[model samples]
Target: MPAFDAAAEFDRQVRTLNALGYPALSGRTEEQFAELVAPLRAEAVAHAGTPDEADAPYDPAATGRVPFVLVVTRALAPIERTMPLTALHGGKLPGFVDRTFEPGSLERFVATEEAEPPGRDGVHLLFDVERGEEFCGVVPNDAMAAVAERGRSLLTIEEGVALMTHAPRILVKNKCFSLGGSRSGDRRVPAIWISRKAPKLGWCWAGNPHTWLGMASAGARRV
Candidate 1:
């Protein structure tokens, strides 16, 4: 998988924005862009969770509009502040754009949802063929043994037989997408699952900042 690089992405966005005849941002230097995107990237990392509960479907109520605004505003601040008024007021640029120093001004620009539902809580578990008592959670030992036995039995069965079997197959489905679909179009939801003894399963929703930023920068490209 490719690594995430917010600064490089921001730099690319700035170049694209500059080319579109948008007002030249004052301090939109590569270093400045790096500074701005670093926090967002860090936020992304810190927020990482199981695939079932990644950053997807951002809760407007939980995160609010402020953080989103801050990200955009900070990313654009140097550009707005350093760019000359002539660059902004001239036909070269549109009028709706203006520089402001007020904290959280960016937050006001982005919209957020009115409400969100709470996440479900559950414990992580791993069972082996031996059905040792080392497992956790409220499930009794015999019940767990039965579950393991059933799982082994299913795995042993032929695919056709498994399909025909009415017994409930253990299915672990992450609901991150369902939650994310409820939010805005551009947000992302990244999640992961850390099994007790196995490698983690990772997943994400639409919260690709690069794609989202690219789209927004494209809008700015329109002179």
Candidate 2:
């Protein structure tokens, strides 16, 4: 992993999304999907370099530390449709939301102003990610404050899902993290973790702290 040629890197992400079958889930073919996100290539072109190294919470893999993640906003591929398509353990199985989340429960979690992506709909580009595992054991509410204090934005639901979608290696056991960027005006904080050795979409109490769950954040984004 070395410095990336931004255009090539962006193309790689588009290929990844196509390979993940995202287009089909959204009722589009690979070609249509690519066409939809073609604008992001121009956006990605402006950001050229990406770090290749990663510490704990983010595994050491070919992807290393993700420089940026491309998101097909919920407007294009809804979480309810995409979550089940997320694969783990080399695609041996798929991801699933915890049963506790009733239908439409996910819709309640909206991105906080600090964590909102630059794009209002369609695709987005999140840059300078700091997975925020250091906040593990800190209550979600407190972690949110810490992230803001550090001048970083918490990862929104779509951003967190996109991270795992392209970099499954990041979802390590006992090192999973929460999406404090999305809240339902209550205690529930969305999270992605390993359940039964596979990726899982779940939630945690905002006031409670889990030694294994850190709150994730990012530095910038683009439409």
Candidate 3:
């Protein structure tokens, strides 16, 4: 697993959200996002071991090493929804849970590749909300980034949701890249979702925003 660039990924997602005309957040400046990511980055760096890239985690599967895992947290609604079932235990919700909601529901319909070794070789996991299944796939990080960059200009709401849901590997890459920077490897990145309802709250491992949008639209006064 490579150390993930959470701030960069967040920037990319914000840009994508803005391009999609779904922009809602503004108070957390880039600096703030960077500040939030700093500790995680530091943890990655500290554990990285070898100095000057010599001790970096080696990918037996890949010829090189890459830092992985970019965790990002965002406010989705003003009032957060609770999932007592999953939270009651110390176990965290898997990243795939986002597929159960509206937009992500579409992901269950798509076909994707299988997971592979980490480093350069990208692997993605999809949680099918409709079917109650989880799918894994192999993808190129750069390829995923390209799709996201293109999605900024080419994707429709339906397409975006579909991509976000069914093709989460690509969506994560897109979201990660859209948030900024890039990653190389088969690593697990966690996204925390915050509800858009009043008195915003956070949920661990929630990545899709379809449900959040509904709340946002309903709550808006439309100035």
Best by lDDT, which number? 2
Model 1 worst lDDT window (10 residues)? 214-223
Give lDDT per model, in order. 0.23, 0.77, 0.25
Q: How much lDDT does candidate 1 score?
A: 0.23
Q: Which 10 consecutive residues of model 2 have the lowest summed lDDT?
A: 54-63
Candidate 3: worst-modelled 10 consecutive residues by lDDT: 214-223
TM-score of each: 0.21, 0.87, 0.24
Over the stretch 1-223, how does candidate 2's per-residue lDDT look in tens digits? Answer: 3445667768887888888788887788888887878988877776634333222233324223566789877877788877877766475778888998888888888888777667565678887665567778998889988888988888888888888887777677666789988888888999988887678889999999999898888778887
What candidate 3 gets wrong by more than 4 Å, as runs, is 1-27, 49-65, 74-223
**Model 1 stretches with alpha carbons more than 4 Å out:** 1-26, 48-50, 53-70, 74-223
lDDT of 3 at 192: 23
lDDT ranking from best to worst?
2, 3, 1
Task: Give candidate 3's total backbone clashes.
Answer: 31
- What is the C-alpha lDDT profile of model 1 across 54-93, one tens digit per residue? 3244232222110111112223333223222112111243
Q: What's model 3's TM-score?
A: 0.24
Ranking by TM-score: 2, 3, 1
